[model samples]
Target chain A: MKRLSILMLLTLFIMVGAVGAQDAVTVTWWMEPSGSDDHVQELIIDVFNASHDNIQIDYQPQESINDQLRPALQAGVGPDIVWLAGNAAASQYVAGGFLLPLTGYADAYGWADKLLPWAYGAGIVAGELYSIPVTYESMVLFYNKTVFEENGWEVPRTADELWSLAQQTADMGLVPFPYGNATWQPSNEHLMGIYLNNYAGPDNVYAALIGEKAWTDSEFAEATDLLREHIADLGWFGGSLEDYYSLGGNDPTAMFASGEGTMMMSGTWMFRGLGPAFEETGMEWDWAPLPPFSEDADMQVGPYSYDLALGGNLGVNAATEHPEEVGIVLDFLLSDKARILELASTTGFGEWVIPLRYEIDDFPPGTDERVLRFHSDFAETTGAGRYGYTAWTFWPARANQQLWEAIELVWAGEMSVEEYLENHAAEWAQDAADGLVLSILPRE
Target chain B: MAFKIDSRVGVTSAYRWRQILSNYIFLAPVVALNLIVIVIPSLTSVYISMTKWSGLNQPEFVGLANFERLINDPIYWKSLSHNVIWTIFFLTIPVAMGLTGAFLLSGIKRFQMVYRVAFFIPYVIASVVNTELWRTLLHPRHGIGAWLAKQGIEGFDIRVFGSKHTALYGVAFVDSWHFWGFLVIVYLAAMYQVQPDLYEVAILEGASRFQRFRHVTVPGIRPTLVFTLLMIMIWSVPAFDYIYLLTDGGPAHASEVLGTYLYNMSFFRFEVGYAAAIGVTMALITAFIVAIFVILRRRGWEI
Candidate 1:
């Protein structure tokens, strides 16, 4: 009877607290600014506040946000809205029970149909929604159109043609891919995902992601060897491995702009810099999906698949005092498609591009044609059940770190790909056991 | 009469005790602050060091497993060894440069302030700016290396940081460039207080400039010298920023030190428990360094 009375008393207190909180409740969100003004967030937040009476939205722009949020989340206190690097990052928070499942909110808001399926699915961990991918991107083959035309070179569509072009370009004393890791060490993974998806095929890659296929499989081995040989042994990636490391930050990007390389395989984000880079050198540039790089039909890219990435993810904090208010704020943020498009258009369409469902014509007037074409291709391909995973977005944190860093050790000849894969499998196994591995959406 | 005398003595003792209590009460805020920030965190870290944590996940108690893994980890040993090398480099090169600059500046009367400012500019500038300046200036292709090569400087064509053999030393050189200036200012102030009569006596005895520097100048600044040694020892083991900014301990962990390694483990790899072990080990190493310095001072080595 005493226990029952204590429970009753606790319930009464909670009810009273809820009633008190309903008046003048403030829902807080911390976000990294998209641009100087962060017009998208500012405009939407202003609109929300103007529409609401007591529930005010508190949005704070932050830098070094992951570092800030980690301690806050562990202490069971933070902004009502939790920002993370991606869905892969949310796995840890999900494991800790720090993130509130957004499924109820998603159902209430009907966000499942509102976002791109791949992006919406990226937010699901352990068969439940825990995050929402705010920004989405993909990797593609950026080529010097001028260089291709001048040399009468065809854009390679298969493994043979790609290697032949690489050889021919190297023979002429030029960088083929012009890829290097000096500026961003994780650039290693950009090429890794490209080769993995293109050479091993997205299906095999997805199988490994879902723990059905092993990292040491023959196709993966072939991909690793091909990359290792091209980068270090054959000296085709800019120069030798050392040369690649020594490529003074943006030298490869500069080289691409100067028409020194046949192509540079990189992210859509590269478009922002490419215009100025090409302008300086009077070079015209274009892009296509990175081609299939395997002879086996099983390993070839079926139709097409773009390697996907999210700049970051947002989840509601489970420990927050105001879950309902936070959900309302999230619904507004995701639903405001015009604000997102405006931000994308103003920011030149990379960092501020949210993964809401879109039509090509919905883009405001003066949207770049290249941007539209990419969207059209991505929408059509992904709609037909074709998409690949970027390591940063899909791999667990440790595996992601190892994926990039250990590859350098292999290239430097300190470790073989077999040894690296063995370690990778070990890390993946631990992540799997710990429930830190993210659920990859099933292929159609 | 004897009872009254005993009562007076008791009162005096009680008053003394009260005075001591009041003194402690005055110290309470600072003590409380230390307990909150330092003592509590240190104790928590000890607990964390024993567990397997991924920062976000509930730390699973694995008792000394992390330490065992660290002991068996070659990367840990390699990183630790780099820290030691970094410490040795700072102790020697910066100390020598600082001593020489101080001694020279002390002797010169004209443009002393100008010389001090010139030497101190690198130190005074923000670390990012200083690092960026060196990163661009020493870049193999874009910087002086390429320019020198064009001017028929053949051997300088090599990449300083890209090579595993030279990466650690290259970072150390940049750090020393930014750091030696502060050392100069400290050593120069000490040189000023050194008895000028000793230098006069050395000069009268027909001592060479080098001899004066060795005999009078060196011994005169022994306290400052020892203090700087202590400072550099503590700072060098955690030497992160310049190296982190320059190479990120990279190419292939060629320039990896304990600090960068710990950071990578903690944040990048999300091996918080393993990282905590590394952190505790570093704290122990730092304590040992401080202990050595304290012991020497108590033994009157610096005094």
Candidate 2:
């Protein structure tokens, strides 16, 4: 009996050792979710961990990704996965040797084929892939259909129609576009990108972006002038520029839903917010592509052109202990398209509108058709090479900064459009000389 | 017995040395922490000020270039001027308000605690909450401005925070409203420390209420007043959070301070060295102000 008891004890010890040895490698990835709940990260991380048996993920939601990233990267240590605000931000990390070169992982996973071509190329730095664009977005016009119906307003498709409608809206004592930068100062770039694309024409703006033409050209000047007229003088935005500056982000949505404003021009990211806002107000909301503000008949596909933007990117940290595990995680995130879309359908599309090939039919029952429609519109517009560039994605940091901040001066009429463009050109020139410019994807 | 006493005295000397050693031993952790977190970082920042860094790469030295750029930068000068205006406003208006409130409250014996608590509530409230409260009340369309306009009040719908002329003042006003209660509480405590007999004597001498307060109360709280001033002056160098949260130094940077400029340069533009240079300038300005106070004290000023 004693011999049997000793043998059992030995067996139990051996079993415990084996179990301890089999523990999965933990890969840490901190998420900066749009919502405080971290619901998207919770879902994705849970699914990824369950599917991958050999590797587990430790999810941490950060309050401020920028505040945390700056110190952690500087210290040669950070989470296994990195979330950057944009592809441009990822490039800064790449420059600092804080991000891993993902060329090998891309080859192994065929990431180039899996992602949209431009999305795949967005992370390339010094001819090496250092980041991956997890999400692609565009600025769009979201209008209150309830308000539109009440006013008998039709969605404008041309420069003349848009101005006439704006004028009408203004005359009715309703703000034409209740836009502001009170919450996010960089929001000015959204309008800047819209004006230059729809007015300057996507092709001309593209040429200017690639340095084929100067920004001080007549087209851009006209766009700038049009912006000044509508935004500054006409006070079409929130009754006056003063009122506009006073308004926060949610205020515009509320104003639109409550019929105070007929329309609000904002980014696709606001898709998540429109439902609850409209539902509460019992107002129907719908979106239309920002129509081309150009008079040129020669410009092909003038209407329905979108200002393409990369919302954020994912990169592997160079200091990560489990690089191999991180690669599997990256592949799971990027390649598992069906699951991602399912999650997006479950969560409702906003931050998770990734750059993967979408099977829109695969969305579950009772999905909001409005979000799905924007995706459809976006893909169709970009596919036809009728896409413009977002200043955040295309312009280098300082130049992109000037694009938003310096426009305030122009709005105040302290600086002329010509001078503003010149300043923008100078910053762009300096950024280009520093090799900080992103290699833009050529229009098809 | 004499030899034994000498031996005990020798033992006490060794014991005193041991106690001294233990005090340092107890203080070692805190001292080390301060060195690591504050002193070392401050010194490193001084070095960083001279370097061209992106906060991502190793810093490259570029002596005095950032300072030269800052000198030429109109934005920096604009921000500095706003900061000066903020300091002047804080020192004058709030100090006067605090003195007046505390003197009036000190005279009230009944519900004094209630009044103190009520006045102190705003100070204890978070800056974010205070800013939001003021923002809602001051909103051009949806707030009091709009309501007054609805009642047929002309020009009451002025956008205080949105207009360039009033943005800085608007933010400063909100910040001061939050800060005023703290000053009142502090002054009230100092006023208590003044002798009751001195006020009685002032009354007997036929001093008016204002005269009594001016002569007796002010002189008695002089040290506390000077201390508060010194703190405010020093604090002004780093004054940013309220302004940043409220206006973000916007409407073309009408409320921009040195702190916001440093933050933008460091984080947004990734011009770390330039930001460090701005930080150094702020520190130097603070040091210079402190030196003035120190000089005053050295020359036998009571404060």
Candidate 3:
């Protein structure tokens, strides 16, 4: 009689435990594959699952997140949380009522205090936070240290110095800035944004973006002319325009690593690929702030860097059944700075957007010193009010498209600078009138 | 007796009606699939073309405004002209190459199968792989152009896909290189079906090789030739992968075709309404070509 009672009680306990396990909330997360960072994301997901018993996450890595998310959201079926490319994409989803406004959760979680002010401001649409920034990026001048040393050239800090160095580099048979836009024409925006912010000054470009000034303003025209001269007449890229077009995105970095090119202008995100390319050649490379494009001290933003909102912006699907659980997952992902830094240190996944509370010296062991210094320098420069803007993160869709297309025509000499500026200005003005322009955070 | 005969006829007529209804039931799945995938999307596309939509917000009824904009858009006209040029090039070059290849292969016997497989291999390869292969081969630094320059050949280092003047032709050449082989296999099958007596008669009449090809082989393969031409005209309307992968209609809109333009407008610019109008225009062009072919057939032309 005692044995029968014990066996019955044990079976009942086993059944109750199984029922409890089945009741755990399942949250689906859609992430845009970031090459090597995908494994880091998977690791984070596993850690989260192991730490929490009430919630389970199913991670789905998508090749083209926006392309897939748009249709699925329209059909009223999508993952609980999605990774958007930037604030521009988040605004589109917010307008469509596909994203859940996270104002209350953000306040409860103290996200505003934890996140950088500019990053927090970027997620607001019509006075409500609809997304959480997961990554940050900026453009800088990348140069081959070996080549610069061999040629006895100092990194230029002013517009005049830059032009002089470019001339000397050309005389030495090395490309001053190796650029390519044939396969990926939109990459032209990287160089254009840098020049626009540096030459025209961030204030004027900001005004133009927000419709307070015209693109035909003299500052913009000056920038356009400078680009044309470099591309067409000067040929600072070491070849004809045709040769520039023939080169692919990776070709410039490869050339620079091989000591065939002196300098390259690209985003910090390129460090992932450059790290490996430089490793192969045992070549030393470093970055410098962009040279000022204006001689007037007042016009320059003190080596303004064209900072664009990049990386994944996590948002909750409005139709998700588990909103609370999804919010919890987002908080776990963004709030854990230690784990993020540790991952960044160990795996070179340094693109996380959260402002670190810990000291730079506390970075985990095995972190690449070069990568750490790069991020530290980027944080310092952007913190000093030298950050500018990028079109992909700010401009309306149509205006942004026209910006690159018009510039290509200008580069090909098919359209004059005046015509290009006027055309873009008209399109931008109309988009502004339609309330299609995204909110631009004021310069700090 | 007359009433019995009437009853039997009524029972047979009722059985025939049941058979017809069962046949329709068997075809319902295919008809439903066609309606869902083809008929519905086409009709929806036509409706979407008349509205201003960004694929995110509610589509505003703009009624023909998109078409009006397209009429004034220079890029649209440029893309359309490129497509026309593309059609003409494929009609001449690839078709001629396929015919010549088929004629030679049809003459050989020992290595016939091997040659056929070798020629068709490119057609079987994926577009991305094929494009990447050509991109490397035509690269200005390390490709054939660079090698020729290394050998002291002047003017050989020209950037083919990079130059606006040559980008369209370069993409067309790559696309043709992959496509001509399929046409060869098709033409060879049709050539084999031709009766041997006709060739014998031409040979007995003291006809030269060219004369025999013109008199016997040409007429014998007329049906396949006409069919291939029609297919080429239709396929050229949506020629996207090569040009898109190669130049993306770029280096200053030099190789802009309607297909790539439509894709850019829809996905990149979010001008779905304008893209739909372009799509509708493409459909009309295809329909017009089919109508012309039908008319020719109705007028007693063999094609």
Candidate 4:
């Protein structure tokens, strides 16, 4: 009887609190901006505020979102929504229980069905929805059509042909790839995926990550040898391993933009930035898979390694006083297709102008035809893998550190691929001993 | 006689008490500020040093683990060596250039203020912006250094920064440009204060300018030179922003000073405890260098 009275009084208090609160509640949001194009977020916020009667949105642009949000989230005063890169770091948020579980909300609003299956699936961590997909990007090899045609070279379709071209180009005293395999991921990701897809194929690549085989597998050994030999012989990259940091993906894109180089391995997103340059140079540039292996074996450019399911998402603070109102805001902002398309079209106020989803017609004023056709072929062929696919994400931080350090040795010429792989395996096992997850894939 | 002695003792005791009271009164604000600002934060950091916290909520205690990792970590050692080299290198070039410029300018009677202003201008500029200016000047493509190569100068495309052989030195060169100015101004002031009599006596003896500089000017400014050297040694260990902005401790951690390394350990990898160990190591290094300077001073180095 006493409990029932307390429950009734509690319900009454909530009712009073909700009814008494008439002032417009302000919701703070944190996002990263790229000065000009990133301004689209401000417009979206303005539109949302103008249409809403009960809530106001305040946006904060940060230079380093991880550094800022990591502290804020832990302090329990984080923004209602945050923008984060799609990677293992994003998984850390979900794993730490800092993010609100949006599954219930998604189910209630039918968001799961509305979003692309792959896109919606990307943000799910431990079977819980933590973020919604915002943008998608894929890494592909871009080749200079004009340079190749001038050289009378057929576009390379396999690793051997690619190497042959690199050698031929080196003979003529020009940089072939101009890539240093020395930087951290996405660089490592792009390089390793290209090698693995050609050598072990996608099946083995996934298998290796999940412990179906060893990093010292013969195919892996051969691939590493092949890559190292090419590096030693042709010497494509002009800068040393350390110079890798100075060379942005865009640096090569800039090179491709000018008619200086024949090929660069980069993402389709960079195309938007480089399209004008390509047009000015009158060079037809297009994408291609890392050439498949010559061995008539089971492999193609292993499915695209990282596809964006979600760049970041908005989540309400679980401890906030206005959960219902926050929910209404989220529903309006994310669930409405028209709002999403507008947000997409404007490129989220310049955060990403290339919408995650776009039809060919939606290309910006000077989009390249060859570039689109190559991406279409590549996308259709490659399977999109999860982002944040670093060794440290699954294991203890030490294991990841050890792996990165070991790879540096390879570039330094102190260790071979076999030795490096063996060391990484040993380190991973050690991390397992120290209590860290080593596998996230399904068991056979 | 006894009364006189008693009165003297009483007066001394009273004087001591008054001195103590004034000292306390003078120190009260500083004590309060230290407790409120420095001491409390330092204690908090020490406590955080034992945890697995990434500057985030409820840090988990992992005592001695971070230290153990630092002891074994190769990059940690590599960074330490870089810091030591940086500290040693930072001291030499800046102090040498400063001493040389100070000596040359002190002899000039006219336009002393103009030369002083020109030398000190670089010191007043922000380090990041200054380092960036140097970056453009050193850029491999269109940099002034590269443009000189177009004149058929061999080794002109020197790409000094991104090279493993030259990256740290490149950063050091940039930092020296910022640091040497202060040393120059300090030395110049010390030189200006020297009595004209010393130079006059040397001149009367028919000593040349070089001899006068060595005999009179060097001895007169000995204390200033020692102080500037000690100051440079102290600043070199913790001075990270220049190296960070210029090279980002990269080109394979070639320019990894203690400050930038500790920052990367904490911010990049979220290894707070390990970063603390790095911080402690830095403090210990600074303390050790300061002690050496103190010993040198006691040995008649005269700073």
* Candidate achieving the largest TM-score: 3
DockQ of 4: 0.26
> Higher-TM-score candidate among 3 and 4?
3
Can you write out model 4's per-residue Cα lDDT over B214-249, one digit (the tens) per residue?
898889998888777777777777868887776667
Query: What DockQ does each listed candidate score?
Result: 0.54, 0.65, 0.70, 0.26
DockQ-better candidate, 3 vs 4: 3
Looking at model 2, give its docking quality level.
medium
List model 2 lDDT by residue over A8-39, tens digit each.
Answer: 99999999867754878889877676662355
What global local distance difference test value does model 3 have? 0.83
lDDT of each: 0.84, 0.84, 0.83, 0.64
Off by over 4 Å in 1: A1-25, A33-37, A41-43, A47-56, A247-251, B1-8, B294-300
User: What shift in Å separates residue A122 of candidate 3 from its native position after superposition?
Assistant: 1.0
Deviation in angstroms for A292 in model 2?
Answer: 1.5
Ranking according to lDDT, highest score first: 1, 2, 3, 4
What's the count of clashing pairs in each model shown? 0, 0, 0, 11
Better of 3 and 4 by lDDT: 3
Which lDDT tens digits does candidate 4 get at residues A154-258? 878766687788778767766676554222332544454455545666556556666677878888777666655554434565333433544443455556666
TM-score of chain A of 3: 0.92
Reference-based TM-score of each model: 0.92, 0.94, 0.95, 0.84
The global Cα lDDT (0 to 1) of model 2 is 0.84
lDDT tens digits by residue: candidate 3, A1-444: 899999999999998878868878889988887664565655588898888888989888888676798899889889999988676667767877899999988999988887777778778888999988766777788889988887788988778988898888888787888878867878778878887888888878888877788899899999988988888788776356787878886787788888877788777776666777888888888888787788877767775554655666889999999988988988887777777776554335446635544456757676667667766776677778777788777777778888877687898888899999999888887666656788878876
Higher-scoring candidate on TM-score, 1 or 2? 2
